[model samples]
Target: MKSFKHTIRALACAFTIAAVSTTAHAAELRLGSGFGDNHSSTRAMRDVFAAKVEELTAGRHTVSVFANSELGQAPEMVNQAQSGINFGVFVSSAFFNSQVPEIGVTNMPFIFSDRETAFKVFDGPFGEKMKPLFEAKGLVVLGFMELGFRNITNSVRPITQPEDLQGLKIRLQNNPVHIATFNLLGASPTSIDASEMFAALSQGVVDAQENPYAVINSFRLYDAKQKYVTDTGHFFDVIVFAVSKTALDAMTEEDREAVIEAGRLATLEQRSYAAADEATNLETVLSKGVELTRLTPEQREAFRTATAPVLDEVKSRLGAELVDEFLSAVDAAK
Candidate 1:
C-alpha cells in the first residue's frame, strides 16, 4: 500500500511538470503595421522574421502579424506596445518623432541625395545612435526599414518648382518639422493621419500630400483622384521595427535573442526589397494615369534652396549636436 501511494504521487508530479512545460513552450507575439499585407515591410515580418523566429525557437514561439492598420494607427499601436498590450510595430520615423523628437533630424528636407547614401548612413553609427532614444521610451528598437524618399502628389497641379507648390493645401504627417517645412515653402500644411489620407484627398480636404512611391502605390492614392506626381525626394524616412520593452523583458533569454536576430535579418531583407521596388512602383503610379514629373537637378535645387532655412528653424527643437552628427554621417557616407 505504501509503495502504491508513492507511485501515485510521482505520477501526479510528472503530469503537472508536463503541463507547465507545454504552457511555457507555447508563446505568441503580435506584430502590427500600418502598411498593407503586400507591402514589403509586412511581407518581411511575415515571411522573414516570423519564419526565422519559429526556426530559431524550434516552434516554441511564433509571431502573428496585423497588417493594414488592423491593430490601429501608428500612434495607437505604439501606445499599445509601450503599455505591454502584446504588440510590436513598424512605426514610421515621422510618427515615431512624437516620442523622440531627435528622430526629426532624419526628416529634414533634402538631407540625403540618393538611396545608397541614405542606406549607408542609417546602417552605420548614426542609426545606432538613435536606438537608445526608443529604449528610454520603453520600446526596444529592433531594426530600421526604409520608407524611401518622399515625393509630392496633388490634385491641384504639378509641383516642379518651389513656386508651383504655392497656395496648395498639403497634407503633412503629424510631425511639426514637416509642417514647418511645408509652411516655409508657402503651402498651407495640415496635419493628418495616414489612415484618413485617402478620404482627405478624395473629399478635397487637402489638395496635396507627399510619400514614397511605394506608399503612394500601396495606398492606391490614384483612386483619390490625385492627378499629378512629382519625384521630390525631399526626405528619406525610416520605418522603425520596435517592440515593447516590457514584453521583451518577459521573454526567456533564448527567445529574446531569437527575436532580436529575426528583426536584424528582416530589416536587411526589407531594405533591399524596398530599394528594388521603387522603380516598379513608379511605373505602377504612371499606369494609373497620374502625370509623373521627374525634376531636373536645377528644379530640385530650387526646392533645396527654398527649404534650407528650415534647418536653422528646427535646430533648437531637434538639438544642434544631434543634427550636426547626422549631417556629418551623411557627408562621410558620400
Candidate 2:
C-alpha cells in the first residue's frame, strides 16, 4: 500500500488539488478519511455520504471521497479542511485534541460501559456542547459516528490485566491523555500516526498497538504480526464528521443545507453500520487465528483504577469548569 501510494503519488496530488477547485460545482466537496477502501466507514462515505450530497443538491454539488490517507493523515486532512483545501473530514476525535483540549474529556479511560451510553451522550446535549470548540478552529461540526472501544493487540502476549501491559511498546493515537493512561499503566507508548502503524508494527519498530475492531480488521494489523488482542474497552471514541467553516460560509444557503443533510444522514448510517459490524470484525480477526481476551469485571475495574488520575490531569490542563461540565453532561445522559 505504501508503494502504491508512492507510485501514483503525483497523480493523486493533482486529483486532490483539482478536488478543491473553487471554479467548480456548488461545493465540489472533497471528503477525506483514514479508513481503508474496504472499511465500513469508507463505504459509508462513498456510498451514502457522497451519494446523498449529489442527490440533495440535484447534482449541482459533488463529493470526491479519498480513503486510507490517500489525501493525508488525520491531522493533515483536518488542517486541509480547516484551510479550505478540502470541504470535509471524517476522523477520530483524538486528532482534534490538539485544537480543542476540552475534547479530551471524551477519551477518558473506562468512561462509558457500552456503545449505547456513548450514543446517548454524543447524540444528545453533551455532543452539542462540543460543537463550538470545533467551530472556533475553523471546522463546522456536522455529526458524530462511532469509532467505538479501543483494545490492545500485540505480538507479545495476551493482556489480562493492567500489569500485563508493562514494558510493551504500544502504538497509541497522538493524544496526550492516551499516552498518560498507558504510561501510568506501565507500558511504553509511542505516538505513531495510524497511517504508518502497520509498517511500524511489521518492521518491529513497535511490538504492539491498539485500535477498535474496525481499524484492526481494515488495516489488517494481524498480518503485521500483531495477533494477541485484549478487550480493554478503555476509551469509547467518536469519529467527528466536519467540514471547513470557511467553505460553508461561502456556500449558498441551499448548497450548505444539502451538505449538512448529507453529513447528518451519513453519520446516522455509519453508526448503524458500526454497531452491526463490530462483532463480525472481531470474528474476522479470530478466524485468522488471532487470540482474543475479554477482560472480566474485576479486570476492567483494575484498569479503571490505574488510569483514574488521567481525568484530574486533563481537567487541570483544560479548565476544570469545562471538563466538569462535560462529566456532568455524561451523567445527565445516563
Candidate 3:
C-alpha cells in the first residue's frame, strides 16, 4: 500500500516540473542583426531593447540577440524573420528592396538635407504608406533607427567633386537605387556585403567606400587602409526593426506590447547617442591620420545635380505619389 502511494506522489511532482519547463520555453524571443555590439546601431538598439523588454515583461519574457550575421547575412535574415523562422531583425532599408521595393526610395541621393529632414519624412506620411506593404509581405515595421548621412572614404585620394569619384572602384550596398546613383556619378560600383568591406578594402578589392561617421568609426575605417574621408552627404541609410507577423500573432497581447515599447525606447536612445557625438568621432578619425575632406558648397551642388536623374527613375519605380507624400511631410516639418 505504501509503495502505491509513493508512485502517485512521484508522478504528480513530475507533471508539475514538466508544466513549469514548458511555460518557461514559451516566454523567450529571438532577435537578429548583421553587425555586432561594438560598431552596430542595430546592436546598440537591441541591447537597450532587451533591457526594456525585461522591464516591461516583469521578467516573464526573455530576449536573445544574434549579432554580426550570426544567423545569416542581412538580406537572408530579413527573409527568415518574415517566414517566422525567427522573431525579428534590425536591418537596413537596402535589404528591403527585395521584399518591398518602395522603401528603396530612401536610397535616392540628396533626398534629405539633414537628420531633421530625414526624420520628418520617415516619421510622417512617407513612412506610414510603407507600413501596409510590410504587412502584406508578413512583417511588422517598427520605427526608424539612425544611420547617419553617408560620406565617402578612400585610400586613393581626396574626393571633393563628382569628377574625383570617376573611375574609382567603389563598394556599394546591394540596392539598385544606390548602385544607379554611384554609376551616375561615374564610379565603378561593386556590390559587397558590409562584413567583407574591411578585407576587401585592405586587399585592394575596392578603392573607396561610403558610410556615416558613426560607421566609419565603428568599422575602424580610419585604419591605414583608409586615408581620406569626405562628408558628401550623398544619401542616408535607415534601419528598421521588423518582426515576423506570424510570430507576433503567436504572442500574448502583453508580450507584443512589451516588444513594441522596448523598440521605441531603444531607437530614441540610440539616435541621441549617434547624433550627439559627431564632433568627437570626427576628431578621433582625423587624429588617426585620415584626411577629412569637407565638400565646398559648389562641389556638393555639382554632385547633387549629377544625381538628379536618379531621383526621377526612383520615383517612377516607387510611384510619384509616394515621393510627393514624402516631400509634403518635409515641407510641413519646415
List residue ranges in candidate 3 displaced over 4 A: 1-23, 40-43
Please list the residue runs of candidate 2 whose C-alpha ends up more than 4 Å from where it truly belongs after superposition.
1-22, 25-27
Please give the CA lDDT of all the candidate structures.
Answer: 0.88, 0.88, 0.83
* Tens-digit lDDT string for candidate 2 (1-334): 9988887997888888787664575457888989888777778888898899889888877889899899989999989999888888888999988777778888889888888888888888878888998999999988889888998999988899989989999999999889999999999999998899999999999999989999999999989999799999898989988899998988789988988888888888888899999999999999999999988899989999999999888888887887788778778767
Q: Residue 26's C-alpha lDDT in candidate 3?
A: 61
Using all chains and alpha carbons, the TM-scores for the candidates as numbered come to: 0.92, 0.92, 0.91
Candidate 1 C-alpha lDDT tens digits along 1-334: 9999999999999999999886664477888788987788998999999999999988888889998888888789888887878558996888787688888888889988887898798889988888888889988998889888999999988888998888899998898788888987899999887888999999999999999988899999999979999988888888989999988887799989999999999999999889889889999999999998999999989999999998997788877888889899999999
RMSD of each: 3.2, 9.0, 2.7
- Candidate 3 or 2, higher lDDT: 2
Kindly list the per-residue Cα lDDT of model 3 for residues 144-243, writing each as its tens digit: 8877788999999999888898999999889999999999989999998877888899999999999887777777877739999998988888888888
Estimate candidate 3's RMSD in Å. 2.7
1 or 3, greater by TM-score: 1
Report the error of model 1 at residue 298, Å.
Answer: 0.9
Quote model 3's TM-score: 0.91
lDDT value for candidate 3?
0.83
